[model samples]
Target: YGDLSKPYGTGNPVKARCPPNNVVWYTLESYLPTLVYGCIVDAWVTNGKCPYACKFRYESNPEPGPFISAVNEVITRGRKIEKDRVVMYRNLLVERALERLKEIYWQWLKLSNEDGPSLASLWSTGTVSEIPTLKPFCSLVAEKKQLDKASRTLVLGNGMVRREWHNKAKLAKNFALLPNLESGDLNPHFAKTALMDLVEDAINYLEWVIVWPTVVQAVRSTPDGQSHLDPVIVLDRS
Candidate 1:
C-alpha cells in the first residue's frame, strides 16, 4: 500500500506501482485507466510508512484520503488479451466500476461517523470519475463453486461478449476448474501431483485464450521448429 492521494507518471495514484512496473511501463501500461491499482492496505503499515517504498512524509497514514477499502487485485492490463480497441472499451467499464466501488467505500466510512472525505472521490483526482466492472477476486466457498462465481462475475463485468468476440462460452470454459482425468485410477501418491497438473493446465488454457488471436512467435525457432520462450507482439494489449 502507498499514498493514493498523489499521481505518478501515468496518473496512477499508487506510488508503489510505476517505479517497480517498468517492464510494462511503455507497452501495456501506457493507458492511464488500465494502470490504476487495487490496493489492500495492511493495518499496521497503513498507520506506518508506505508498505514497500515508504515515502518520507505521510508516515501517519500510508494510504491516505478518499480510498479506504478496495479489492486486493490490481486492475492492470497485463493479464488479459484484447485488441487496443477492445481494451479501450474495457477501460471505460473499468473506470466506471472502479469509481463506484471507491465511492461506496468512502460513503460507508462517512455515514458511520468515521474520518474521511465528506464526498465520494477517485484516488487519481479525488473526484468522481468513470466506473469499471470486474470479478471480485476473493471468496470463501467450495473451490468449484468459487470458480463458477468468479467466472460469472467476470463475464458480466466484461460487457463485451455479444458486441465483440462473442465468445462467452469460451470465456466460461477458460474460467472453469477442470476435473482430473480418472485420478482415482492413479496411485494415491499422485493425487497432489495430478491436482497441480490440472492447475497448471488451467493457467495454460487461459494463456492460450489470451494469446491465440494475436500471439507473437519468435522469428528464430529451435531446429525442430519449437518456440524457446513466450514472447508477444508489444502492441497486443496497448
Candidate 2:
C-alpha cells in the first residue's frame, strides 16, 4: 500500500520519498489507559469538578521527567550546539504528537458518544462496517413550502433517521472492532478492552495524520547528508 503519510503533490507514487525504517518504534498501547485517564482528569479539573485539585487549564509546557533533565544536562555538557538543537527538536515533535493524539481522542469520543451521532443500535450491527446511506434534504422545508401533510411528515421522519446515521463513517474510519452483537452495558473487563481498542485506533490515525506528515516534513526540511545523531522518534501517542 502507498504510504499515506507522504504528500504526493504530483500524483506520482514513485516520487514519494521513503525514509529509513531504522527508527525505533515504541509500543505504547500499554500506557494508553493512563494517558486517557489523565485527559479525563484534566477535563474534570478544568471544569472545577475535581474535589482534591483546583481548577486547571491545559498547557503546552514540556513534560517533566528524568529524561527531560538528562537532555538539559547533556546540552550543557559541551555537545555540539546543532546536535543539542536536534534533541530539543525531537522532544518538540513528541509534544506536538501528544497534542494531536489528545485532539483525536476527544474527537473520536464525541463522534461515538451515546447521544452524539453513531447510534448504539447501528453500532452493534454488521452494518457499521459499511458507510451509512443517508438521505439528503432531511430538512422540513416541505412544511415551510406548504407541501402536503404526507410530504411534511416524510421529511420530518427522514430528518430524525438521518440524525441517527450522522458521523457513521467517522466511527468506522477511527474505530477497529465490530462492536458486540449483544446489547448491554460493558463489564469492567469489556470496558477496558474497548478503551484499549479506541487507543490503538487513535494511534493508527495519528500515524497517518500527524506522525508521517511530521516525519516527512522534518526530513525534507533538513539539509541533505547533514550528519546528526541516530534518533529514536518517540511519538508520545499518550
Candidate 3:
C-alpha cells in the first residue's frame, strides 16, 4: 500500500504523516533538589518579611543591616517565649485534667434525691460503718497519684520539660510587659499580629537550614541537576 515513487519511505504518504520530533527532552539530575532548595530559600525570605509596623531606635545611621538584626532579635525572643508558652499550656491541661477527676469523684459520692452520701463515700472517707478498707478503689487513687507525680516531675525536671515550662513562664511575663495587656486577657488582634511575626521568623530559620551552603555543595556534587542525551539518524539508498 506504499507509493513506488518514494525512496527509503521518505516520499510515502505514511512517512509524510509521521509525527515531528521537535520537542526536546531534558532530565536534569539535580533539578529536583535544586528546585526544593530554591523553594525553601524563597519561603524563608518571604517569612523574614515583617507583618506588623515595627518601631526602631537608631543609635547612629539607620542601615538595613541594623534594622534586620533588631527584627531578628525580636523574632528570636518571641520564639523563646512561644516555647515557654507551650509549657504553660501543658500545665493548664494537667490542671484541667485534675479538676475533671475531682468532679467525677464528687459525682460518684453524691447519693439520690435524699441528702445522704452514697456507699462510694466510704471509699473516700475510710468509714468503719462499711468495708474496713476500700482497697479496691486504691488502684484508681494510685493511678491518679501517679499522674500527679508525673505532672510534678515534668514541672521540676531539669531537661527539655523544664526548659519548656520556663519558656512558657517567660512568654507570660512578656505578655505582661505590655502595660496595656493584662493577665487573663484575650486580645485576638495583638496575638494574631505577634504570632504571625513569630511564625514567619521560625519558617525563615528552617529555610536557612534547608538551603545551607553545605547542602547546596552536596547537591551540586551529585548529578542532581544534570542531564544527558544523544540523537541519531539513519539513511538508505536503493
Candidate 4:
C-alpha cells in the first residue's frame, strides 16, 4: 500500500507471483485423451510439478491445453480446499477417481505411443506412473467418526473413547495429507515432516493391530510357564 513506483520489482505483486510450468515437452494433446487430462492436472497441482518429472521448456502460451479443461476444473477445486480447510473427504475421493483414470491412460499410451528408433531410451524415458492409493487413510477418517459417535453416547466410559478417537483422527489426517504433500527438488525438507508422520502412524498402527494381540495371546496360553511363544515369531508369522 505504500509504494507503487517499481511495478515489476514490488508494486505489481500479482504478476510477480510464480506460475506453474506448461505441458510443452510431451505431446499430451496429440497422444493422451481428453478425459485423462484431469488426472494430469491433479498430479501437477498436488505435487506442484508435472507427473514423471517431465522435461522443462519455455512456451509462448502458458495456459493449459484445450484438451485439458477438465484438469483446470480440478485445480480450481483444490484452491477451495486450501482456503476453507474443509472437504478433505471430497479431495480424497477425487484422488481415487484420478488414480483409476490414469490406469486407462497408461494402458492406452503403452499401446499407441511408441518411440521409433529413438536413442532417448538409452539415456532416460518419461512415464505416467501409478498414483498412490488413499484407501487406508480414508478408512481412518471413517473409523474415527465411529469412535467419536460412540464417545458421545457411551453412558459409562470415562475419557478413553474420546482420547482414542482424537489419536486415530490425527494419524488418519497425516496419512490422507500425504497424497497432497510435495517434496521439493531443491529443498528436501518440504516433504520430510509429512513423510515422517506417515511412517510413524504406520508403525504405531501395526503394533496396536498385530503386535499387541499376538503378545497377549502368547502370554495367556503360557500361564503354566512350561513353554512360551516368542513375540517376534508370532509377528513374523502374521
Candidate 5:
C-alpha cells in the first residue's frame, strides 16, 4: 500500500499526525540517546547546587586557618580584664563610704552621753562617781564593719551600686539613733530630737557619697569596665 523504504512522515499513510496536547511519538533511534542525555544533565545540575559553598563553610572545620582563632582569644581576654577592673573600683568606693559611716556613728554615740546617768540613779547605785567607763560599743561597730565588707565584695555598678551604698548608709544612720530613743537610757524627748537630727546628717552623707559620684559618672559617661580602675570616673569604654 506504501513504499517500503519510505519513513512514516515522508511517504507512508499508516502513521498518524501527532496531537499538539498529547504528543508521544519519537524517532526510534533517537529515543534512547535523548533519555540518556537528560539523566546526565539532571545529575550534573544537582551536583553543582552549592555555587557559594566557600562562604558557608564552618569555622570549626579541620582545615580552617589561623587568624579567626587568634582574634577570638584576644576578645575573650579583653572582656575578662574589663570585668575585673569594674569589680575592683566598685569595692573601693563602698569601703570608703562604710568607713565614713562608722566614724559618724561613733561620734554621735559619744556626744549623746556627755553628762552620764541622772540624779535618780544615786539611790540605786550609791556613789554617782562610780559610773562604768563607756565600753566603746565595739560589738556594734564590728557588726557594721562586717556588713560593710560584705557590701564591698558584692559586684555592682552603675546606678545599682550607688543605690545600695545609699540604702546601707541610711540604715546605719537609723541604727545610730537607738541610744536616743525612749527605750534607751537617754532622755526621751531630747534623745528623739537628737536622733532625728543625726538621721538628717546620715541622709546628707549618703547623698554626698552615693548620689554625687553617680551624677559625675553619668555626666562623664563612664564605662563599667575601666571605671573601677580609675579613682575618678572616665567615660570611655576603651
Candidate 6:
C-alpha cells in the first residue's frame, strides 16, 4: 500500500502503477480471485456447498508480546526513511494475499446466511468449528442502485452521498452479503466493490489516521513552525 502512496517515478507521467505487488498483480488480483471465487460462485449456483474455515490464525504459536511489539515499532520507523523501498516492495505481496483472504471471508459470510442464520451472528466476531450446509443462495435484502433514478442527494463528511453509497451503508444490515442467486454471478461486482473499499481504507489510514496526527504533533513540538519533518502529501485515489 505504501508503495502506491507516491506517484511512480518511471511511468509515463499520466497514471501510476497499480500499487506494485510482489506476487504478480495479474495472477494475484485478476487470476486467483477469478479462479477461487469462480468456484464458489459455481457451487452456490449448483450444489449449494461452500468451504471455509471459521476464524483464521495469523501465526501459530506466536512470538512473545514484547518482541513482536518492538519489531512492529521498528518496521514503522523504517518506513519513514527513503531506503525502505525494498521492505515495502516485499510486503506488497503480503498485502495482496491479505486482500484475497478477506474476499474469501465475505464469500463465507454469503454462505453462512443460506437458510436464515441468526442476524446478530452475521457481524459477531466469534468463530466455530461447524461449517454450515450451503444452499442456492439469495440475499432478499440486497438491492440495485441506479444513478439515473436517484431521487435525492446528500453530502456527508467530505464526500457526496447517493443510493449506491446508501446501499453500501445499509449493506451491513445483511453483513455485506451478496445479492440473491437469481441475480447471477455477482462475484465480479462484489470484487470491484471490495477493491474500492480497500482503496478507501488505505486513504483513510494514511491521511486521517497517520498523517494528520503526525502533523499535529509536529506543530506542537515546534511552536515557531521550524520542525525538520518532511511535509506529507497524499495524492487523490485513482
State each model's CA lDDT, in order.
0.29, 0.32, 0.29, 0.29, 0.29, 0.32
Native-to-model Cα distance after best TM-score fit, residue 168 in candidate 3, in Å: 33
lDDT of 4 by residue, 1-238 (tens): 1111111122221335452122211112111232333444344234322344454543523444322233344345442223232234234434433443333222332343253312111101122111011111112222555445331221111111122322233344332332222222101221132223322442234235434556778777775635644433334565
In model 3, residue pairs whose N, Cα or C atoms come closer than 3 Å (at least 3 residues apart or on different chains), thus clashing, are: 29-224, 29-225, 29-226, 30-224, 30-225, 84-167, 84-168, 85-168
Tens-digit lDDT string for candidate 5 (1-238): 1111222234222347642221111211123223323332222222222222443434424332222222233345542234454344334333333333233333332332455533222111112112221111112222455435331211110011122233343345454432321213222322233233333343334335434546787857966555655666568988
- Put down candidate 3 lDDT per residue, 138-214, tens digits, no spaces: 22223555444331211101111112222243343332232221211212222222233333454345336434656
Model 4 spans > 4 angstroms off: 1-26, 29-35, 38-85, 112-238
RMSD of each: 21.7, 20.2, 26.7, 27.1, 43.6, 20.2
Q: Quick one: best lDDT, which candidate?
A: 2
List candidate 2 stretches off by more than 4 Å.
1-71, 74-80, 84-88, 91-108, 111-238
Give the C-alpha miss distance for residue 71 in model 2, angstroms. Answer: 4.7
Which should have the higher lDDT, number 1 or number 5? 5
lDDT of 1 by residue, 1-238 (tens): 1111122244333455544333222212122222222222122123322233444566446453211111111123435434563344333333333333232233332332344322121222211112212113112112456546442222111220121112122233331321211323222222223233422443345445545535533343344434555454556675
What C-alpha root-mean-square deviation, in Å, does candidate 6 show against the real structure?
Answer: 20.2
TM-score of each: 0.17, 0.19, 0.19, 0.18, 0.17, 0.25
Candidate 1: where are CA atoms >4 Å away? 1-84, 109-208, 211-238
Candidate 4: which pairs clash? Answer: none
Candidate 6 has a TM-score of 0.25
